[model samples]
Target: MRHLHIRTPRRRVIGALAAGLLCTTGLAAPALAAPTAEPAAPTLADGLALTPPMGFNNWNSTHCRAEFNESMVEGIADLFVDKGLKDAGYQYVNLDDCWALPARDADGKLVPDPVRFPHGIKAVADYVHAKGLKLGIYTSAGTKTCNSAGFPGALGHEYSDAQQFADWGVDYLKYDNCNNQGVDAKLRYTTMRDALKATGRPIVYSICEWGENKPWEWASDVGHLWRTTGDISDSWGSMLSILKQNLPLSAHAGPGHWNDPDMLEVGNGGMTDTEYRTHFSMWSVMAAPLLIGSDLRKASDATFDVLGNKEVIAVDQDPLGKQGTVLSSEGGRWVVAKEMKDGSRAVALFNETGSPQHIATTARAAGLPEAGAYTLRDLWQHRSYNTAGTIAATVPAHGTVLVRVSAGGRWATRPPAVELGLDGSPLVQAGRTAALTSKVTDLGRTPATHLSVTLAGPAGWTVKAISPTTAGLLPTGRSLRTKWQVTAPGSTATGSYDLTLRARYRSLTGTRVESVLPLKATVVVAPPAGVSSLGDLPWLSTTNGWGPVERNTSNGESAAGDGRPITLGGVEFAKGLGVHAESAVEYYTGAACETVTADVGVDDEKGARGTVAFEIWADGTKVASTGVLTNAMPAQPVTADVSGAQVVRLVVTDGGDGIDSDHADWADAKLMC
Candidate 1:
């Protein structure tokens, strides 16, 4: 089930922590240690999941669809062996929801759906076990499961369900949060934990309370992994927002317990390959569970490549168990470093902008000991380079450059750290020549000699050097800038095209070094020079708290086209968009839009129950906002001057309260160019 994005009371969180500490140590309140005496965080007694559990979960790709049956699960088990994922350390083949009957059996035990599992769950578990893999199952903490079908959950029947799961040879349990009947979060979860232990099975307990009770602060001893955020959608904005939420809890993750930020979305088809790489890389660096959330039967080769990157996975499964911390974050450029068991550090230079940016971090800053030189191994490209101390790259838009750095030995012979970047916006029209400037800098101590740089684009594109491209010698910290004119073919489609910058130089030891950097250039068609309805244009991206954003309708329910006419305070409108709270719709304006206007308010579909706020963003800056609108209020007009803005974003946020029935409408939305 989808989780609610809300914060727990601070008093509750603090009380829970104190209570958990006391419970774990079995001490009375007065007999506990003083506040100054920092007690060790309690860990699960079961020695399972020494590293974050690597496996597959079917929720993201199939959800509770008809395809999520016994054969599909057995097929996934086969893929784990056939696709080399078993060797890569993926063990669990899990079912998410809709696996059980609507009600318990005569013995008050869960029953596998006969249609979905004709041979029973135990048979499927046997099939997976025969492949040398394990099996995981899902249930909720309440009387009913999360889906609308209302399958039987394991709440009051914890002991019976736990015994049944053990009888079925279950290796893992994903206990979700839904219909929980206001029971104490700790009590409900601790009961299940005790029940699982009593079964004498090593079932990995995944607490899926969605951080509503601040699980990370006190769930170390409760479960193997605890979700730290709401459900994750397969989109760049969703991934980025979840990453920001989970990055602050690095201290709560350790060897047997992890701060789960949900599952992987690498092959979900909702993001680019570059964005998928960043997803995989960031998740790996965070020491998160490497649960593959995509359907394997239809996975593309590229998707499998990202999922099977052993080097990246190694960082996640490192025995050191230290979650990565943010070395630095500024203007959407983040440097995260994780200390490895081998004394090396896995560093990720991430660019969250719309253009390429040069992100760098020093070895000292990455917690490495002082050494003469550092070996920088590109985990994605699988190449090695030597740097004096600087680890940097011109990371592409919505991309990440992950590298593992160690010191000494062969790395003592330093190679020039060539940093490459493109000047100005990398956007051009089809068949038009764009003057692109490539700046190369040497960040090494010794000078680089016989340095030459060349630029290459796609096959149909033409690139001509407009300035000097060769240099005899480049001193330390010196930059060599060259200009080039790149022209795309007239038939070039309106999409992102890749350009490569190759540089070659000689180090002080007379060893030749080569570096290749990739850049992305987009070809766009500006909006027509007139007023146009926003619903008529294609959105660059969208993220919603509930279902898909609807056009010319009210936020009816949780599915697309379930909406009705856009209505606010009983006034119906024929146009504009309808969305839930915490929603964002982004459009590429190409710096051609001047004004955006909309009538905003909470949709009447929720009566007078919803509260929301509408905001207009030009680029990254908020240009206009409608202060807290409720369903009882009439539509309010909002106008924002978005001149010279390359992208315009529409945002709707929960208004102070929680996002319950937060059906917001942007009626009669229009953009003027």
Candidate 2:
């Protein structure tokens, strides 16, 4: 779902009227009137999606696999009711692709896939409606869909398909852009808009054009929502990139139309819980769609907690429908504020760096009126405090603190804010110990009494306090620091484990309050002391634009083991890694590797159609890079200095053009210790 195209901003032209003299012996001539006003841009006028649509889509969790059947769809509908999502404003249960047969029926009508939908699409839609929910379907604006399977689409059959959807009780349509036959984007989308309007059924239209045509400039009148960036993957880099792309277009979003950055990946397990919270908070602040894109059946309690946060959801569903604006952003620290319907401001302090940072912003800066005092409510912590118009927090890396600020509220005591940290890397060997720290600060107006902090790890792991873990009293603007040594058992598996930090204290009114923060620890094995092929080692994490990164092969199709011998510019090698553009593979070196060497270039499998660049990073610093390599060039040797580096990352990015066919190869990549 990636696209690249240049777009010129549309402009309005005005004509000047000239007056004639007495050439014909005439007196004063009548003045020329201004041209008639242009007609208003066409809007849906359906009064739908006044707030960003809240729902679920199956593509992210189950794509066109066998698990995406009627049973699964019905099960999700049931979970939406049982898991309190329905009550929380999630309404639609949608299907993305591969829902219909490959060909049209005798009357040129789309036929439901019997194997996927036993009783047909209508039966499933009826089931969803019975649960007081709605159903949505997907189709492309071309002759075929995006998947390699190539299902039938609705390009030349807009009216017929619209009627069929209305008759089948469909309430929403997600029209995509693939194989579009080079048609004008506005014309294609407007045609469907007219077709849907003629059906007399209120169907939400989602334009999925991947922002190639600058839809934000004209799509507000055509679709209820439009995709504002490329597809999203479950990685920190992917989420951050998309966020940057969508944030600058805030002026184009409002009530009835939204800028979509794709669906949620909170429970996908590719990132930590802290990162997921940041993802949810940013999306809500931007007033983006709140579509759940994970499998609810296997979702964890932590995932549900993030998705079911009512206060955050309120910011997204606010009746004012104003998207948050960036107050300040510098040095990976950001402050964003959204105007709410209740005359309050929703402020978010976000930290995108690799360490904690203190971000600050005043009420006036956030678009709020002057008052004696402002009430700041921490949406995630569910606490309120009275402040003299100052909103600030020491946000953790990849974490966000969301607060609602309003004027003229009763002064009340609030709980102290606590931050957790690790002295060194979170990675540890089995039977090894690590140092953990905590800082509890009383930001309220009064003192906190009987303050105590404790660190707890998983069962069978030991935690011992290295410093005083309790305090009798903590005054305002004062902090209490505590440290602990956590040891993992020898039998512990090589994976991530959760550690919890708990703090308890009495407020000004002598009411006991408690706060808990979750932390992640990873156990990894160090590489052997010798030169070895990188393909033989385990990667800490990987994110590729297409399928999984291949081992010991060339970039082939988008499937594991589908590659052939490692080939670059007609030269073949026996061992290497194959990846697509916009890819990253990270490995834990534990500061043991001395150097890394590789032959990098665009894979020959794509002929002369790809352009990409290769980069090597050590401990967040770029060590070496191949500026730009194309399929027309030969393989180039690259060497990177990795001395005293704990981690090494290999990256492939699209080279100026786009990621159309940027299949890249890392031939004979080796790490020497």
Candidate 3:
């Protein structure tokens, strides 16, 4: 079911998951405080969505196709009850896009498409209710919906539309942001919230702004569930992308307000069955709204299995409603833990890498009570594990191990930590062998001995490598460096290849426990074409964030973004903007060609926030700039007039909102005549 799909805003291509998150934009300009009660609250939130909403959304699976009719809705409603999805808590039968008529009726009221919904929306809602289910509708805050759906948005029609939906027995509303014309996000959203409140409807208001303007900061009082990231597609990469975007905002999610990572992509075939389970597990742990976006009429068995994991669903529906968070990340493994209402914890060992990995952590390390043994239950396999102080798991490539730990038992002794990292640049050009040194450090008191390093190249590609063989004793707090000669094949593809690096060592303590640090080397193959990519831009660096220099060939993260696209220049570039949001890129206007041009815009995916200016610097002086960009504007084609500058310094800065949603992007950024 497809309609006129606009470019999905070319959202960020998520790279590594960052270990930390930026709580606030430390822009030099003070952020304006959230609106106060003197202006009166905009909407009557009234504690809706006490838990993340469990339902079905039509956008991801069937987007405004001719099949998007009342029967389709009724068919899904029947599946909800027949297939036990309703039993597991999925209730809403939603109409996402294309259900609205081309225009409002004579009284400016939204009318259902006559051909598609010959019986009208009220009749459909009544049918859903008859099946013991709820109904949800989709609209936009802008002038029009995000699809070719002919109905006008609820911008000026919010109150009347809200009343109309209420009268039609609608129980949910997904308000989107398209054709919004860059109006102040807070004001516009608040307007619709008040309009819904005026109708005295108990609708679950879902804000679909796609994380622009930092909705988490101000939407707690506005909507029940607000999208904290871009849309989700039925692919592992897209799911992980949305997951990483919403995970760090865990603190803002709760009983009444949850971080919406958009609709679910499970049951879709873009990902494998295992990957689908991982997708559902992570979303459940994050306490995100579980809106199934698949056609139920022809659901697959694997889809049913992933969606019907009642034990996992219990974690999501726990009355405590506390969203899980990443407790510890080592190598490519993450130990995510969530507290349950019954003093229990749901822990997920997630392996984000493409290789099988062994990840172990103590209860204390994962934020559990330092001194208690926990009864662990395997949620997926439906088995129980022996009470233990430590959880050591071997996760498959891009897989997960989710378990529930019951509190109150024995105490655990903290384990030693060994860190393995590369000493030189992680990026290597094709055909060149680089001296890759692995720095192994003992962060704990346990002495390490008999250390060895192993390296593996990409599969199917022959890589010439001379790795370090053996090492002697390394006392606690001591560090050792081993060198490896790694050469990529001359004909290697121009992309990022993970070089598997494993450090094996034994604890020289009385117990003599062995440990292995699974790390990967990210080598960026320069395009055989010769022009440097945006990430490889000579002087591209940011003025913010901590640097593990989260760099790849495409996107990177400086400390500020916390694994988010490098936020800088008053915009978050899903491309690699380095360090902080106020950084600059240095390049020759004639580096690889004649002129350096890029389509620049705020990183708000669509309508970027705040005012941003792009400045071109010459020898210690400013030359050209696209003044301060107004709020909610589209990306402008900016060609810098670097008249006589040799090494041009491109600078971008936040115009006040303290770099709020100022993720600037330079799409198709290149140097050309």
Q: Find the candidate with the highest TM-score and give its number.
A: 1
Q: What is the C-alpha lDDT profile of model 3 across 91-152, one tens digit per residue?
A: 78888867878788788999888999999999999999999999999888877776643357
Worst 10 residues of 2 by lDDT: 20-29
Worst 10 residues of 3 by lDDT: 18-27
Candidate 3 accuracy as TM-score: 0.60
lDDT of 1 at 672: 97
Better of 1 and 3 by lDDT: 1
Pairs clashing within candidate 1: none
Ranking by lDDT: 1, 2, 3
CA lDDT of every candidate: 0.81, 0.77, 0.63
Question: Residue 92 of candidate 1: its Cα lDDT?
Answer: 95
